[model samples]
Target: MKTQNQFQLFKERRFLPYFFVQFFGALNDNIFKNALLTLIAFGAFNQETRELLTNLGALLFILPFFLFSALAGQLADKYKKAHIIRYIKFVEILIMGCATIAFWHHQLALLFVILFFMGSHSAFFAPVKYSILPQYLERDELVGGNGLVEMGTFVAILLGTILGILLIRIHTSTLFISIAIMLTAVLGFMTSLWIPNQKTISNPDLKINWEPFSQTWYVLKRAASQRTIFLTILGISWFWFFGSVIITQLYNYNQDILHGNEAVMILMISILSIGIGLGSLSCEKLSRHKVEIGLVPFGSIGLTLITIDLSFAHGLYPEQVINVSTFLSHWEGWHILIDLFFFGIFGGLYSVPLYVLLQSRTEEKERSQMIAANSVLNALFMVVASLFSIALLTLGLSIPQLFLVIGFCNLAVTMYLYKLLPEFLMRFIAWLLINCIYRVKITGIENIPEEGPAIITCNHVSLVDPIVVMASCHRPIRFVMDHQIFKIPLLKFVFQTAGCIPVASEKENPEIKERAFALVKEALDRGELIGLFPEGSLTSNGNIQQFRKGLERILNNNPVPVVPMAVQGLWGSFFSRRYGKAMLHWPRQFLFSKIGLQITKPIPPEEFNLEELKNITQNLRGDWE
Candidate 1:
């Protein structure tokens, strides 16, 4: 459960074999892909031929996801995922063997056929690769597991791409590359043999639908069953769109604009890969081993900023840098390298959380189907990116302009996503507050049940009490709070996204108070966690306020269990009322100041009372204040 170093998963039979299977598969695909692309773009100068080969190659590889993913999802769900993976790897070996023959015979058309089949091989493997993790890994391990997988994926990509570029330029290079891919495929199949098979079938009684179009629609609809899941899917597809655009254009961006050769392109890509590896590794630590979607916006902002900088960073080195050393000799080259590096870093940050969220939220029986839908969407978006890139370039837009345009488009997309579901923004804020401003020690977090309706009673000590409590729980809580809290500029956005119920004193606004209770009832009926400060308001002084009787009102209607919580060590801080007013007086509590959230086991309705709840809160706070 520690999962501090994702590399430890390599020792796990559940994870290690599958890791290699995916790694080798990715490596094999990229090596062949980059080699063919290098041959098409750089091996010849035929304009029409280059355009045709490049477009055809991209289309051929991505088309399978559109056509066969539904079938892949069905097979993965209906049978043993491990068996499907093994069979896919076996197919990969055959595909790579054919690749070798085509390379040997200089059969261009045959190579494309092999590429399509390779795509088919991956299309089948992807659903099983993703969906099996939840079965193999614990909830806490999901983020780290995904981090390792993503890191391995990009690392494989880095090695494959660099190898593809270097090997193709050598004497009898295709011979070497062809042999390498075939051997990789064999290694993939062999490692996949060791992946432990699960006895449980996700859907044994389900019937397979061979129809691609309608089944594709069925899977997509299923994946989008929840609003958050669908939006996450959209966010994921957008990432693919961004990635494909950058990769598809990197060759042209290097040549036409930077006047660089293959070495420069390889160097740029390598930095990006390294950045992604580091970023992916950091997710577990930054998110504290949780599926923190907060990192999504952070990653998106970094991505947009880095890309926009890339547009301006270029044109510094007008002349060609013959080699990597020469490219590094100029600061301008370093700028481009840095831009691409952060691109990878933010990309990893953006994507890892979404995968974790998607996997963790989905139902077991339909997990593979959901992932298949995500894959379909990703493929569609990537195909659109390919076409969009071509159209823009053909329209005489410089690569720099293209980057600028994409960056802005990303900004727009994120804004829309955040608006659609404010949780993304709220989580980002809570994550920042917990990780950056306070060193929080969360105890009794498990007391908050993972499911069912519950009322959380806490002794509020500061304006950020809800935030501290919110950050501690695995599930989202709809906190009942003073409506005036929304009047605060910064806290307003956070509270709004968190779906905090804004209540008022009955004398001040009776209708608002009525509506607040109505919303609370609705949320509890939906099996959500509702957090409210039993003291009714933040302590005007440093002492805990008297518990009001409103707690009984909530319990009367709901009869749900109560989770007693306490927030401590926040008095006199900026958000606490100890310093005259919250946020008005910024006195004390430097970065990472000690803060603690303590929760008691859920008190059943039979045993719950105001006196006992307050006593539990006091004990949890434990003389801290």
Candidate 2:
């Protein structure tokens, strides 16, 4: 199978139409929102009142998500998502039309009401928008699809904000701004009409729970039942909170800190949005077209470091910069912009994997509800971010200092999460090991079952074979390794996090050997994959060794399918025994040596010949080692 580039998704109907619908919808939203803010800023009002109304506008917009996301999730679960998208888009057109009248009449109350309704439109659309992708696209396509969606959204928001702010500055700004938002809404509805209907509702029997509070709690509880899913939700919410703080402060940061005008604000927004878009799109390639959570930790680290850099990027410049030119002229201003851009890039890396993981792992029936729950948490976090910023700024923290706090807070939260759930960190280590040490080429990867219990039998060629295989497979596997390998100082933490099974010979440690077998049975019973290297020890001369009877014992008890895998090209590498002892090496091949993993079709339980299994592995690894 070929890996599809994320951009290729735009050529298809299932993705392209919805992508436009989202793009136009988000564009309209920001156009109206920014237009309102621009009015408040330049209107005849004091700074305090302007700030109050601006914050109020934000609150009103977010209120509907908290109030209506549960109902939206239920609607998505019980009804076809395409129909729901159409309804939401239709509502958006009406809301934007009414918003146009409000803009013309300068009716603050009506516009605020429309803003709440617009938020409701987005809230209702959120669950359906995401949950429908897996229904239409293949499992491998999900990462690319999500990346495109996220990248499109940020770009639309950037363009919308720039247009909103620029147009609202004109003398007859009302007509132009009104036309833009109204047209975008109409276009969004038209595009939504082209979205194909889902085959059926995910949970047709799932009753609609109208009460937001109780329904919200109910959905959240169901979603939280799975620890990893719940933590993934938290990770996504944290990203929103961090983003909210950064984007919210950009206005003031441009004016007060950077001493620049609205145009400079546009530049900052542009750079940040572009960075996120690139980062989001990069996820598909970086993850090798799979749902790799390692990118999450990598992304979080990038976000924290970049934001810290932004906090310290402040300067004691005395000039009153007027536009983008003056702003870009100073190295300090460029420093800030560069930070914002990279902040976006890492933010993209951080968020896209999480959304993919959430969508792919959740059950089809409860997927929308879980997404709704995520939406609820996201809104709550964003609200708290606004309040958090307000509180900090009021407590005499400069905006740059606020960014500093946001960075450290992100670091603290991610570290806590990694402790609670180490999969993110574990995957990060494996990804790093694979990328740095070897270029792994996997063949017949499709032969690996997508689910259920299975036994993986591979020839152990190196000390890091488990990590290499773990990184290649999409699902997590509880690898069975020699107890001695577990004692390695640098890798012990990762091994523990991954729940690796350590086995010793019965003579060396009977208790550990017995416990290893028990754990193997337990893991298989729970429908988990268990990895075993049946040769019993690493080959010193790069040759397959005699098969161990342990494989026979495990299969007898469990009767699970046995998959044969061959790991090649590590014979003389640093992790192989060709250099004295493994890891005590001088020189070998160049870094990133080609490592081939050939996994054959699984053998049925009745055909339980250990010699045949070894022969198949040898064939797959022929002439390589």
Q: After superposition, how far is residue 315 of candidate 1 from its true place, in Å?
A: 2.6
Candidate 2 lDDT over residue span 216-278, tens digit each:
999889988999999999999999888888886777676667777788888888999999999
Which residue pairs show collisions in model 1? none
Question: Mind giving the per-residue lDDT tens digits that candidate 1 earns over 347-417?
Answer: 99999999999998888888899999999999899889878877887787888899989999999988998
> Against the true structure, what is every candidate's RMSD?
2.1, 1.7
lDDT (CA) per prediction: 0.86, 0.88
Clashes of each: 0, 0
Ten-residue stretch with the least lDDT total in model 1: 43-52
Model 1 scores what on Cα lDDT?
0.86
Using TM-score as the measure, the top candidate is 2
